[model samples]
Target: MDPQSALPAQLVRLAQEESFSPQRVLDAVHAALAPRTGVRRAEVLAHERGRLVVVARAGEAGPVPGACATFTLRHGGAELGLLHLHGGDPSTVDRAVGAAAGHHLAVALRDVTTAREQAELHRVTDAVRRLFEEGVRAVSVEAAGRLLVAVAADVLGTERAAVMLVAPDTRVTHVLGVGLPEELEQRLAASLLGRLARDSPAWQRAALTGGPDVVDAGGGPPGRPGGGVHSHRLRSKLKLPLMSAEGLVGTAVCGDVTRSRTWTPADRVLARRLALQGAVVVDNARLRELEQAHLRQLEHRAFHDQLTGLPNRAALLGALGDALDPVTGDGGVALLLIDLDGFKRVNDTLGHHSGDVLLQQVAVRLRELLPAGATGARLGGDELAVALAGPAADLAADLARAVHARLGEPYVIEGRTVRTGASVGIARAPRDATDTTGLLRAADEAMYRAKRAGDGPRTAR
Candidate 1:
């Protein structure tokens, strides 16, 4: 118990032992002190990231009789942990000797912790690389999320993991998880995501991309929606913001379901890396969708009349080609080419804008008069064409009559009543011509004949 006798104790000789570990040193310290000073128990504890965790213990696991002295072990202004001697006479152990051992032990703890981190990083490098590349190869945001959840569960050493997508307005739009219960996932989406939004001063704590947050809930039962709570399940959780140069995308989360845990700095670093990589994946998918939409718009514009929103001349020719294909197409085809008698004069008198309105109205009438298996198109100013298949072409004359009625009806252009007439030309395939070009030529000639004769419509065989 004397201070001088503590000079040559087991703590000092621990360095020479090749098999010395933290636990071995703790046992040795307890053995030397308990026998000499009559202390019943000892424990080494460290406060890391605001949590007091037991590092090593020797002797009684049950409650000690009394709290003796608490020794502070620190090095370079950092508090490593505390060496607490429980029970027995406090003055019987040499305080100076314990203090010296604690200081030396603190240095060792730092080195050992750093080495452990390095070793773990080496072990998980390949797994982390796959997670990062999964984002690159992901076909969609949902696909990326599935990969992220699985990778997070594997990397963080937990049974459950999830990715919650947040909209620009801070709404959790979607939730994806692996090994997470449906009810628990829903609860997390509302409660955990809400807490992250509210408590964060960052993922912007105000923006969608908040900072990383890890919590140790001490293995308690999460709130049940409408049912009574029973056993404790989810304990520790880590949530990191999924962010990229494009801004906040969502959040990545994982947790231990079997036992309680506190996330260490290494765990946090891994989560952040995964979240960021997954963000790129999501952003790329969004960009891809936008590009696809734009391409669809371009394709529509290419084959459609922008003015009247109808198929253009090229589309009409395509329809004619399809209708005239002997093997695949209907047995016979008909082409109706209509030339407006007074539309040019109206365009010349009115401005182009008024002419456009008249054309749009003409398109509307054409669409209304168009039969179910027919193609209608504006073949350049005042010249419109209609193509129909075998059975439908039998109504070509009737369709021409309907067109005459619809076009001859007064059009209200710019609040002024305007009247126009149409000269119709009808040509049937295998009678007038079998090919689209010849059929169209015959229709044009017949239309001219109707125009010259000043009759309503004319049919060419």
Candidate 2:
């Protein structure tokens, strides 16, 4: 095609191209100008991170044979960089073509920059989504909070990230951190709290209005009065509130300590996203914890004596059953049932409260006498039960002696001193009876026999 006819078309095509790229536009400019202006080379340099970076260049750049022209690439009235044309002069055609190419390059560079930023934002959004999913999947509050801080640290590219949960009394609980020492993390939390008053702007915004607060101390000297001491070595700080429908539950803190950092809009957005998801995870974990605690309490109440805090008859039977399971019963098992002696007289004289205290004391002595692989439980008023993994004989004798010694010593209930003795009976699995019910019955019968015969202890037949 003739150069004159092609020039207008080339310029028009460059103008109309939707897929704008810095290098593609530079190449097209060189092709169009080399033919018309006899330009041997063209180069586009863009300013990046305080320096000019060569973005695209076309044709060999040795030396210009004629006049060379350089034009600044401007976008939105600000100079982006320089566009240079070699072997060129300011003839009306050269100037017009160079200016037009410069304009295209400027617009294309801006488009590519924006596209890059948008792509990055999408990636960050995806990552934040995954972080929330992991937090939600975590089985415990500690695990969830750790995941939150770790993810925040990685995403923010900060030296330290931490989570602080506030209690109703304004005290902090469960302070956790990533990339920081436990002691230092604790200190950081303490220091931050010391600076944060209930009425402070950060607290008010986060707890009341649900806004993020940031403090950036750009790589400059510390402005606070105490210099290195009060600054806590932190140059930049970002705070996001962990909010729920009930209000603020906690705060997430991101800090840059090694160097100062300018908080970008993108960084702020990331902080907010993390806090929003983290709050839900934290709340869920806490609620689960409360539920678990409630369940444990119910189980305790169902299978334990409220007065003595010992396993009740039901729990004792369940334990005996477990010990006598066919797979594990080879070890053999022993059951001891004990009844307090002369306990009715103490109750009749001193009152039921004193009886209750003496029962509690008897329970404690039984617990002290129990060895490893043995469990102590309360059968009911004035009666106790013991289950041991090994065979009885010597073990049962030792336990009976210990209980007699401890119970015979004395009891202090509501500042009153009393005395009592325990009648213990022994039953053995496979020897006396292998099942829970049979073992309990044998032990009970032996205990009664001991009491009636005035014997210190007795064994089942």
Which numbered prediction scores highest in TM-score against the true structure?
2
User: For model 1, which pairs clash?
Assistant: 201-205, 202-205, 202-210, 203-209, 203-210, 203-211, 204-209, 204-210, 432-461
Worst 10 residues of 2 by lDDT: 222-231
- How does candidate 2 score on lDDT? 0.76
lDDT of 1 by residue, 200-317 (tens): 3334541443567666756434534421111114577777677777567777667776776877777777777777776777778667656877898998787788888888889989
The C-alpha lDDT values of all candidates are 0.74, 0.76
What's the residue-level lDDT of 406 in candidate 1? 82
RMSD of each: 8.3, 4.8
lDDT of 2 by residue, 230-259 (tens): 334567777778887666767777777788
Model 2 spans > 4 angstroms off: 1-20, 27-103, 189-202, 217-232, 328-330, 390-394
| Positional deviation of residue 309's Cα in model 2 after best superposition, in angstroms | 0.9
